[model samples]
Target: MAGLWRKAPSPCIGICKRPGGICVGCGMTKADKKTFKRRRSKGERKALFRILIERLDGMGRLARWEHVYRRRCDRKDRPCPLDKL
Candidate 1:
């Protein structure tokens, strides 16, 4: 059972963030501060990269839509004062 677990693929992509931050995309938890420390096979890494790209693309689209909504609201003279709350 231990060998089966060991053979299971890792979730690390080579594109790691600085200071061991959790990946915003694949959500891979870093075991250490060193970048690319997780020993994932090439195939695993490629899959992780694809997931990361999809996550980023989704986030980008959401952000653009949010910006457009905010701009539209502003143009209509809607007073979005934080202090009003």
Candidate 2:
């Protein structure tokens, strides 16, 4: 059963440059990524996503990130966690 459990998809979107304190792609810091990796529960990940979504929207990059994040989910055939938010 453990092998059948699939972890949630990351919100990185492959753009990993953090010029400031935040990721230009996912609106998360390096610390955020590390925290995300450590969080195993869907509730924790989804809660983080909500915080990042608001930040991204404030930065005017939410649309692009959402587009890429959705595509990433599609490629993996996994449900977009954002959808549940």
The candidate 1 region of ten consecutive residues with least summed lDDT is 1-10
Q: Each prediction's Cα lDDT score?
A: 0.40, 0.80
Give the alpha carbon lDDT tens digit for every residue of 1-85 in model 2. Answer: 2211235578898888787789889999988988777776666776788999998999899999999988988899877676667
Q: TM-score for model 2?
A: 0.86
What are the clashing pairs of model 1? Answer: none
TM-score of 1: 0.31
Q: Tens-digit lDDT track for model 1 on 1-83?
A: 32322243233323455334555423444542233335345454445445544554554543443344345446655532211
User: Weakest 10 consecutive residues, lDDT, candidate 2?
Assistant: 1-10
Error of 2 at 63 (Å): 0.3
Error of 2 at 30 (Å): 0.6
